[model samples]
Target: MADEKPDFEVPVGLFEDFEDLKAQVARLTAQLQTLTEGAGEEADEASADDVTAGAEEADRGDAPEDEWQYPPFILLLDPPQYDDELRALTEWVEGVLVPGYLAEPSSDARWCHLWFEHPVAVARLHALWLAWQELTDPASCGYTGPSVWHRDHLDPSMRELRGSSGPFAGCTKGEHQIDHRIPGLVPSAWRQNDA
Candidate 1:
């Protein structure tokens, strides 16, 4: 008998709860790390007000010039940043997007397990994730944010990402195209002139 994948049904709301818990845990961990580091510093150098202000700034999602910026475009990031962002993107795609939205794939609708290897797919999915983060944040977008996200971002992104002529075109539901190649662009006129 062929091995079949187990089908475990997950409640839709559970993903959201999990995400919230993760965010909370991350925030607490960061705070703990900051406090621990501060403890090591000369006590007089780090004032209570300074710590409080830094915490408040973090709570407000404010960052100094050197801090990591959000909604980073995958293609534009440096290698280390790209790897970190790609890992997070993969988690979001596999853990949340696919589980919640992607339907059983067909000839018309497709998905590639190696989507991250496809540059176009990576760019598109990164954009979608960036929008998701912005729209889903209660501080940035209020109660109606999720609705706006679905209407303005999710629908179009998903359609394009899974469309028959999209990045995963040659891939199928049951199999990934190992030799999938991105179509080449026209040779640069400048390079031709140089030649």
Candidate 2:
């Protein structure tokens, strides 16, 4: 028995796919490291000529107008950009926020499965995500970053989002309220005059 070798079979395509995924991960990791290292250095080291040249290129439309800027607000983004951002937000919400903090659901602490459908909820969650990113970054927010995030950003946002009277008021732990509606505001006299 000791002399006999155990027989196991692995699929050829699975090995190739695994190798491809590893290579992609390596490339992405290198790119992320480069960007992280350059972020502050590039800003500080840029000469006036570099700035002027960049501005000139932008004016000439050589730079793409839709080039992403950091810390983008979800509501202000174009449809394509918004869709990309929403995907990322959904990932964070489902992966981190829900699993870590909001797993339990109750009458007092409600959560909507279709949270992204609610504009106000989306905006608030986006803001909370932005704050979480900044506050949890050690270089940006220091040693107390996580603590600050929980105390200042997380707690309030969660309370508001999960409150009984909040945006998820119509939703419940077990069900999503498809027909949930925001109350209509009274029309302004000036706007009514235009009609």
Candidate 3:
């Protein structure tokens, strides 16, 4: 067969139909909300549903139990940018969060005791954990939110930080990775320096 490009199709004129697109999106959103609300049995059962909605509302007040609420993240850091902030954040993550989480009975097997060595890995993993918390907040996060979080954030970060081709690839020694140390405790790396 002669070389040929496959036929492609798109709306004939989208620029002229901005209002139409907005209307369509509004309709779809309403439909999605309707489907998401389902038979209204949950509304009947949930007293708190009358008060607030979605992630923003969840930030306002305590949500009722029996919803998909996730506890506040215990390991949150400041928007760590400067050297001081980074040092503090790294300290908290490695010295506090990692050790504390590992001690917890609920800590996941996949992450347990996996020393995240690289600074980027530390920051990225912390960010992912924070996103997971936000995505699992039942009051604001939709039913599929956690699934989205898993697909979009957890899967990719885990792969990059722990995958065979990624940061922790050669770092593991059996169940343990020897390449990492608690960041705050690494005197060699963090020794006080005069600029």
Candidate 4:
């Protein structure tokens, strides 16, 4: 095994070039750190009005880098960087999401088109979709795939979306009928109760 040839080949002079680039990066990083530290000290001397003005920029959409509107998993909005992201999400929703949720009519979960517009629903859906994609991917061999899908993604999202104390609490109140009901959707029995 010791005499076996390695799979990769490295150019003779590439090592020195890598070392040179590494040193340059370290030097530039140190310079940037010093500049930022100095700028922070100057910022502390600003008047109260100036600090308040800076905060207004955040509300005005001028400072969104640190205050992005959507989570990182949301690839469809904020200018729609990934073109295929929406397509993939749509396909999954149509193919898996609808059927899975509707399979159990008694499950508290039902299809609501307006959920696409709700902020909380959109965020959790995007997270769950991303995790489902990763776990089903052929190249994803990590042990964390299923764990993340169930623990970090699905459980919390479902709890937030359909738990008794969740957003749908009032929507699902006393509406058990061996069938799912959309949030805020009134069935005939609901009207009868008011009589």
Best candidate, TM-score: 2
Write candidate 1's Cα lDDT for 45-85 as tens digits: 88899989999999997998755576657887778989999
Off by over 4 Å in 4: 1-72, 79-87, 101-111, 142-144, 169-195
Ranking by TM-score: 2, 1, 4, 3
For 1-195, candidate 2 gives per-residue lDDT tens digits of 899988999887676556556656775787798678768585768999988999998798575455544677898777899999999999999899998999577888888889998877999999989988877765444446677789998899989998987888888767777466646886654334433
lDDT of 3 by residue, 86-148 (tens): 555457667755675433222122343444445556667667766766667643454455777
Better of 3 and 4 by TM-score: 4
Whole-model alpha-carbon lDDT for candidate 4:
0.59
For candidate 4, lDDT tens digit of each residue in 104-129?
A: 42346643444554445666777789
- The local lDDT score (0 to 100) that residue 129 gets in candidate 3 is 63
Relative to the true structure, candidate 4 has a C-alpha RMSD (angstroms) of 12.8
Higher-lDDT candidate among 2 and 4? 2
Q: Which candidate is the best by lDDT?
A: 1
Name the weakest run of 10 consecutive residues (lDDT summed) in model 2: 186-195
Which 10 successive residues of model 1 have the least lDDT summed?
Answer: 186-195
Two-way TM-score contest, 2 vs 3, winner: 2
The Cα local distance difference test for each model comes to 0.82, 0.80, 0.55, 0.59
**Cα error of candidate 3 at position 126, Å:** 0.9
Query: Candidate 2: which stretches are off by over 4 Å?
Result: 1-54, 57-70, 178-195
